[model samples]
Target: MAQQRDTAEADRTLKAKHRAIWASGDYPSVAAEIIPGLGALLVEACGVKAGDRVLDVAAGTGNAAIPAALAGADVVACDLTPELLEAGRLMADRSGVDLRWREADAEALPFADADFDTVLSCVGVMFAPHHQAAADELVRVCRPGGTIGLLSWTPEGFLGQLLTALKPYAPPPPPGARPAPLWGDPDHVRALLGDRVTDVSAERRTVLVDRFETPEGFRDYFKERYGPVLAVYRAHAEDPERLAALDRDLAELARRHDRAAGSGPTVMEWEYLLLTAHRTDTSP
Candidate 1:
């Protein structure tokens, strides 16, 4: 009993740390530039329809939620960061779409069971420290026959490789924390979802990164706006040489993955896994 309580306390501390890290940066700027493509994919893949009650869990700045609302669905956008939720509210207002924005954790969503027709997360929920609890909340809020759409970075993908490159400079993750890239694995996802969902499937897709004139330019942009990247930079502020080495390594990774050969701006392809599943009916 004491062990369980200790574990729970540890999880809460880790989650608090995650929330602070994410809120430290201006993620909306980065999300604005990248989330549209993934949002469109989720809309189509989930077969979102008018009047569908949609929940965008771990929604960052209303990327998928705002688009889902524009599609005529009733949307609720939930995120742990209040700053990001405010950004999402502004974005929805500018786009002439109404969305219910809530500050909530993915692992313990405040919504009731079987409440949504569709649940979507674009490169979001994978970062949750407690993957199983996050998965359970996702399934719990989705109605039977409802669709759940998720986009995650594969271990072999650009974003995954970037994480690997940054690891040498970053602090180790908390004990018992699952790596985010595991969400990209079909088998792992299936195991996570278990028998709670049916018709589970995964597809590999490529999303093009914004073109950059040089690898350094790409690195600079992420450092300025991406939470995790910015956190790493801040952590190494006292060690200039270590930070420089980290930057160089990141730039090298970007250069190697550049899809545009000798161009004014180089395009980079980021591979991601698209997962879709239907919540199983519990009624006898």
Candidate 2:
């Protein structure tokens, strides 16, 4: 009991900072460019169909939710940051897709138990401070036999490498916080989901990131709009040396992955894991 209380308290403290960091940037601009196809893929992979009640947890700018809605599902887009939720609302309106939007935390979802036919998160819930709590909430909200789909950056992927490169300059997570990349590991995911779900499957998928003239330009573009990258810059506002070192590291990583350095804009493939599982029947 004491450990649970401590963990909950720690999560509360960290969540405030996380909400602020995510809200600090205009993530919609970046999300708009990368999320559509990924969202569509998740929608199809999860078997979301017309009349299904779909919940896109930690949905940034309504990526998955919008597509699900367009497919005739009743979609609700939820996120911790109100700014992102608002961006989702605007984007939904522009897309002529009607969906509900809610500002809610992934670790403690505001919905009732067994409330959704399909629950999805795309590179979103992995950022939750408490992985187990978030995972439990995702399972709890999904109806029996419903589908849960997720996308996460693998530990050996480009995004994972970027996170490792930025670790030195960024603030450490709470003492017991699980590493987010664990979600990308199929075995780890199976352990996390445990017996509560069945038919667990995972696959690797690649999404192409926008091409930039140079690695430095690519780094700069992300720093301006990617929430986590913006947070790192903000954390090092008074330390130019650390910030410069971080920027150099990011640029180097970009250069290392850039295949067409001298030919044309640098297009790179970001590999992520697509996970799908069905909630087990709890009725007895």
Candidate 3:
């Protein structure tokens, strides 16, 4: 009981940071920027076809799911966060795509076995507490010979660099904490998936990130948009001085953004690995 509370508290802290980071309309903007490439990669990598039954796990704000639906797939989009799911559904409706939204955890999916022709997640698998179970769950619902497609950001990429820069200013995160894990890393994901899955493959791609007006723009955006993250910060880290320092640091970033204007894009780059695999039937 005590352990659970501790875990919950820790989660709250991280999520607050997430809220602050995404508040500046960057949440949807970045998703919009990346969805086209992510969508095209998903199609090519998984060979998705019209009328396929697709599962989109952690379908944040309908980035991948909307595009997949546009391609004529019947998509079931699921996420752990109801707020994100709500936002995703709204976006889908606005886009005129039919996406079935569900609130569910990626590690323990609520679906029948072999229910989907294809399963996909955009940088979501590693967020599960039990990554192995999550991977298995994804495979379980996918029909034999069906494709499972995913995109995971490399920890060392520009995304990580941005977080690294923020680290010096913000309060420390819990130990062993990373924004998300890259289950697409060959050795790591293979070890997690085990021998049950067949024909597993992965490819690395470069993602161009724009729309961050400046470093401050990025910080302010997150501060407002991500609720869970904001809630955590409000609850914990009762240090006014630290908060003041964060404000100053973000102010400097805002200045940098203004200075870079009329020059060109800030040109932050993120590396992602796209993974594809076939779910093998367990029945003898």
TM-score of each predicted structure versus truth? 0.95, 0.94, 0.75
Greater TM-score among 2 and 3 belongs to 2
- Best-first order by TM-score: 1, 2, 3
Candidate 1's residue-wise lDDT over 1-284, tens digit each?
A: 99999988987788777888888878887877754678767878999989999999989888789889989999999998888898889988999988899999999999999999999998899999778989999999999899989989988899988887878877888776788888888888899898888898899988887657888898998888888999999998999998889889988888899877647576788889999999998630
lDDT by residue for model 2 (160-275), tens: 88888888887776676887888888888888778999998899888887657888988998898888888899889999998889889999999888778647787778889999
> What's the lDDT for candidate 1?
0.87
After TM-score superposition, what is the CA distance of residue 183 in candidate 2 from its true location, in Å?
1.3
Q: How many residue pairs clash in each candidate at the backbone level?
A: 0, 0, 16
Give the lowest summed-lDDT range of ten residues in model 2: 27-36
Measured by TM-score, how close is model 1 to the native structure? 0.95
Tens-digit per-residue lDDT, 229-269, candidate 3? 34334543687886667656655544443435536545455
| Pick by lDDT: 1 or 3, better one | 1
